[model samples]
Target: MKKIVIPFTIIALLAACAAQPTAESTESTEPTYEAHKQASWLLGRWENKSDQGNLSEVWEKKNDSIYIGASYFEIGGDTVFSESIELIEKEGVLNYVVTIADAGQGPTAFKLTKSSDSELVFENPKHDFPQKITYNHKGDSVIAVISGKQQGKPHQETFAMKKVN
Candidate 1:
């Protein structure tokens, strides 16, 4: 009887150990937004100075799914252009929205068309000039490219910016 009881107790102990939960097993299975994770890398201040204008872009993460940024373009010490920007994850899709202070229209939104570890592209074919925009991050610098058809002709602008903060 003692031998049989010992064997049964050992079996019960093994079963209890098997039933215990593990750290990985208890982890949530909910899906995480990959775009938000990718966008987190853009948070910081970037600036560029050139003969045409001095441009600066500052980005900050507002929350888990939203990033806010602002861009300023100054020519000859005068503010030529400024815009408020937002990167939002809505319904699992990423949108880059720009609200130009002088555009005299509603915010323009560009949808994410392509993205990688160090690059992102947004496009809005229905918008006027600059229907496509791209940002390529390399080390401590970023190259911003905006291109599209303007006046029935192709036009593109590129800015090489370095991280300032």
Candidate 2:
């Protein structure tokens, strides 16, 4: 009886091991993007210190197709500049819109050029200053990059921002 039991236990353990997935089967499939899924990561406050002032942005979800953000800069105990931003899905594509307080122009729209789990890139070739805007999330920090042609010369600015609770 003991001899039979030992052999049965070994066979059962071998069967279980064989049933486990191999490395190839465990590989993840490519992720599909839903408009709201990517925007949800931005639903928080972010801040950074710069020579221009204390820059901050607050973002919130409005609906499945829209997310709103407000950005401002403070200098010498006063709010010097402000802008309203929005991420909206249009015609099956995502767009980033920026409306400044007194820019004397309509909102500028940047199309979504690239996106991933931790990064988003938008671009607008006709915009006067920034033609490309990118955001990359790494751990607890986000690096925001703005680059384009200024006066026919290339210019770029990077902001290292930390998320606020």
Worst 10 residues of 2 by lDDT: 29-38
**What lDDT tens digits, residue by residue, belong to model 2 across residues 1-165?**
999999999999999999999998899954433855875777789999877789888889887678899988899769889999999986568899999998898999999989887999999999988999898987768888999999999999887888996
RMSD of 2: 12.8
Which lDDT tens digits does candidate 1 get at residues 1-165? Answer: 998999999999999999999999999966577897987778999999988899999999998788999999999999999999999998789999999998898999999999998999999999988999999998889999999999999999998999998
Q: After superposition, which runs of candidate 2 have C-alpha atoms over 4 Å from their true positions?
A: 1-33, 50-52
Query: Model 1: what TM-score?
Result: 0.79
* Ten residues in sequence with the least summed lDDT for candidate 1: 29-38
Top model by TM-score, which number?
Answer: 1
- Candidate 1's displacement at residue 2, Å, is 57
Candidate 2, position 93, lDDT? 83
